[model samples]
Target: MGRKRRLITDSFPKVKRRKGGPGPGKEDGAPEPGLRGEEPCEEILAAHLDETHLEILRQFDLNRHFGPCTGITRLQRWERAEQLGLEPPQEVLKVLWAHPEDPQYQCSLWHLYPI
Candidate 1:
């Protein structure tokens, strides 16, 4: 009987790419509130926020004892959303910019803080 021969190959497993960075699905494109060239209304914005901001709100919504107050400011929220690859509604941004200190219901400010 002949001795068994071993095969040596240099092929190694490919390194899997980690899912990171802002992708298309979440990139901040134009705020599309399910319509064309139309501004997203409060309702649509709320829906979008609920889908995205739920988790973030939990972290930033401080003053828990005082009841669900947004820990961070409106500007922080907008920046976070943008960082997360989400396009904040133009109207929402406008509303926040108009009243940086005061919160607005249209931007879901009521949800995080008492407005």
Candidate 2:
């Protein structure tokens, strides 16, 4: 008798996601408020977003978090978004450049105080 071959997919099963929401799970383009979490952020519910910002979001995260775009400062978000792939529009860069006071948001933002 021949041995049955084990496939790679057999080792990892895909997660079963709820049927709706803007997440990659069900919805295609934009996010709907998560059925489990708080109502989606105001920025998310707005019928229209700035065109350049819209382009940036579409490029930055296809599987975006359906929550507030807060916490991360505006500049940090744009800078980090570019690191992944796809540069945001030049207008975005210009706007961010005009405001240089943006503090970075990341795990390493705080250096330990010297003992």
Top candidate, metric TM-score: 1
Report every candidate's CA lDDT: 0.51, 0.48
Cα displacement (angstroms), candidate 1, residue 1, comes to 99
Residue pairs clashing in model 2 are: none
Give the TM-score (vs. native) of candidate 1: 0.30
Any idea what lDDT model 1 has? Answer: 0.51
Question: 1-115, model 2: which lDDT tens digit per residue?
Answer: 5999999999998877667544454447544456435555675555244445445444433324322234554456556657756464556566456445533212112223232
Q: Write the per-residue lDDT of candidate 1 for residues 1-115, one digit (tens) a residue.
A: 5987655643565555448654556655655456755754787787786555443433333423323334555566666766766665555455455445544432344554455
Worst 10 residues of 2 by lDDT: 104-113
True-structure RMSD, every candidate: 15.4, 14.7
